[model samples]
Target: MATKNVLIVLSSHDLLGSTGRPTGWYLPEFAHPYYVLAPHVKLTIASPKGGHAPLDPGSVEAFKADPESVEFVQTKSALWENTEKLSTFLGRAKEFDAIFYPGGHGPMYDLATDPDSIALIREFWEAGKIVSTVCHGAAALTHATLSDGSYLVADTPVTGFANAEEDAIDFSQYMPFMLETELNKISGGKYEKAAEDWASHVVVAKEDRLLTGQNPGSARDLAVVILEKLNA
Candidate 1:
């Protein structure tokens, strides 16, 4: 059987915390999905501007010290290379069956506003493909629209990086607006969260073709749902 192609969306920002403390993409968000999906699918990583996507140092540090994390890291070596540019991926996204976005502050700054991302999402969903986003990565969803000219997430029971999670890390002030509030305001959807931190994740919506994760920790579960929906 031909391997199914999965597009992995990553953040382009390489900054630390809002305090310039050096933050990058959450490592677990990348590792969990990569490991979970590798055995059954071919994966390609993408970023808005392409090149090297940054990893949150804090996330990377934890991955370095933990044995289980390190084991997963060694198993998924494809992530260490530079990802494809978002523009290029968007142009050809239809060839894939699944598209996923990992969480990190970088997405809030770029994907949330990138026209290419919005178009890619619109195309993916309209084509009946499985779409997934975790943590702040759901910021990309804020820009997606439906075939009826409505926000794709409007009225969808989805979750992402929440206000409480931001507050816990003291990064709320740096965010232009909380993701949950912004998603609710734009789509008028009933947003939900598992708990205070990004560690707690949930897959709130799983209709025909959409799968969204609340935070980093949810990435593994999110991939499972995506693979199931695709194979089903």
Candidate 2:
């Protein structure tokens, strides 16, 4: 069988706090999936804003402490150093077998509302390609519309960065909106979550080719499920 081609979207935002601390894609979100999928498939990295993707400082620290993540992080090809801009990729969504959105607070700020990103997602969904996102990356689904002009997630059970997890991370106060609540309001579908910590993850729905991960912890698990679908 041919190798599956997957697109991993990262975050371009560089600022983290009111003090202007540096922040980018959460390290584990990218590192974990890249390790699990790259050995078996061809992976390409891109972002909504494209160009040099940013790395969240905290996630970087976490990666440094773990040898496997450190190894993945050092691999130049996997680092999202340069990427196709979302606008350019939007017109070529069919080239990929699946698209994975790796989460960071940055995605919440950009991916959620970008028209191009929304259309890209709808394009993949309509083509019956696998679509998955973890943590705040799930926010991107907010703007995806179905053929009936309704929200794509309107009836699909899904999950994202829960309010409790946000609170634990102390980022809830700074966020413009809560992902879990917003997804619930838009979907009207049951939204479930794991415990308060980020180590737990759950894939709440899978119908046809659509899949979603609850939080950063679910990143690899989500990728594994996507791999199963692509291989099948």
Candidate 3:
């Protein structure tokens, strides 16, 4: 069998909805999955503009205790230093077996509306490859349309950072749009969540072609699910 290759797309946007606060891809969301997937598959990191992608400072602080997060920061791998531009990877989706998007407020700002990101996702889905996202990374699916002009996530069971979770952080107001609300409205899918905020929750839909994690806590579990699918 050939080696599995995964494309990891990180948000390049660094602003937190005009709040004057800096935000980028969350540390654990990328670090956890990277550590889990790296040994098993070849991984490539990409972003909207390529080069260094910003890191969410709060995420770094919050996940500092995690070993993977610690190694990710201490090593400063080239994977994070020099991401390829998303545009360059478009139309080459078949080269990869799967694609993963890590979340942060940054994705809500950029990847959600990036034409290249949207097209790449649609291509991956159309090709029956695994497409997964965690937390606000799910925003990338917001505008993805199938060949039939229907939203790719429409009528699919999915989960993302819930509105209540956003409210709990008191950061809901700063967001350009609520993730859960947009997902519920746009996907017309059965969107549910864990009873408690920050708990791990994952939903696999579209016959495993679409997988989503509810929040940051779900990152590792989501990676495990991806590994299972890849090995299956």
Q: Which one wins on lDDT?
A: 3
TM-score of each candidate?
A: 0.89, 0.92, 0.97
Worst 10-residue stretch by lDDT in candidate 2? 199-208
How well does candidate 3 match the true structure in TM-score terms?
A: 0.97
lDDT for each residue of candidate 1 in 1-232, tens digit (9 for 90 to 100): 6788888888887774456766657788878877778889988888877777777778867678756567755664456457778788655757999888888887888788888888889888777788888888898998788768898877777788888878887888888668989887865767877855656666646465778788777888888887887788
- lDDT assessment of candidate 1: 0.78
> Model 3 lDDT vs. the true structure?
0.90
User: How far is 202's C-alpha from truth in model 1 (Å)?
Assistant: 2.5
Model 1 steric clash total = 5
| Candidate 1 vs 2: which has more lDDT | 2
Candidate 1 residue pairs in clash (backbone atoms < 3 Å): 16-22, 16-23, 24-55, 24-56, 25-56
Candidate 3 worst ten-residue window by lDDT: 185-194
- Evaluated at residue 173, the lDDT of candidate 3 is 88
Q: How accurate locally is residue 214 in candidate 3, as Cα lDDT from 0 to 100?
A: 94
Q: Mark the regions of model 2 whose C-alpha exceeds 4 Å error after superposition.
A: 204-206
Residue-level lDDT of model 2, residues 40-80, one tens digit each, is 99988888677788878788786687776677677764357
Q: Candidate 2 vs candidate 3: which has greater lDDT?
A: 3
